[model samples]
Target: MSRAIEVILRDEIFTELEIEYPDDRNTNLLEQGMDSAGFLKLVVLMESKFNIAVPDEDLLFENFSTAGLIIHYLTEKTMS
Candidate 1:
């Protein structure tokens, strides 16, 4: 799941948002300079590629500021 998230992030959002382990990517993307469009694009790609529905509430910066959050959500979705 982390790998998939990383691919979507790197390909759809930032070319440099590398995530070897989703749990380790605690960086605040917005604080670091990522824009809103990039974040939305990643979310869209993630929803399509992973077939996981992300709630509207999950669109918050706190929910997807890092790869770890993405993986955590995806992992939970895949498991369920």
Candidate 2:
């Protein structure tokens, strides 16, 4: 599942943001040129792709700061 999430993030980051996904999953996306719009696009994509609703409280920069973090957040979401 984490692998899948990483792939989706890589593809979407390239497709939607027109930016290369960092090789390091722990790299900060905001520092990599991911802006607010890109972030919202990712949130929507994750909801649609994973079939999970991300609560308002979970929509934090820390949660989506990197691919690894997103995978971790989604893994926890899917587990519950």
Candidate 3:
């Protein structure tokens, strides 16, 4: 997987938001503050790093609600 998203995401988004991963739990990110912009940025970053084209439709809450989830999705996508 591309560490680009993880590095940028952690250093940029989480730090800027002053959000520490409180618990080992959280699935719904939109409820927190990761709105459409974050989702769109992530989609772009992933696409660029992986050399894959991710349709805008894939940038849904169900797909990118969390970093781990996003990683999982990308792993699956790149392999198949």
TM-score of 1: 0.67
As a TM-score, model 2 comes out at 0.85
TM-score against native, each model: 0.67, 0.85, 0.60
Candidate 2 residue runs with Cα over 4 Å from true position: none
C-alpha lDDT (0 to 100) for residue 80 of candidate 2: 84
lDDT tens string, model 2, 7-76? Answer: 8767864577676788888899887888988889888888887899999998888888987888898888
Each model's total of backbone clashes: 0, 0, 0
Lowest-lDDT window of 10 residues in candidate 3? Answer: 17-26
Please write out the lDDT profile of model 3 over residues 12-45, one tens digit for every residue.
5566554443233345666566767766766776
Candidate 1: residue 68 lDDT (0-100): 69
lDDT of 1 by residue, 3-28 (tens): 77666655654543332323347866
- Candidates sorted by TM-score, descending order? 2, 1, 3
- Considering TM-score, which of the candidate structures 2 and 3 is the better prediction for this target? 2
| Candidate 2, lDDT over the whole model | 0.82
For candidate 2, the clash count comes to 0
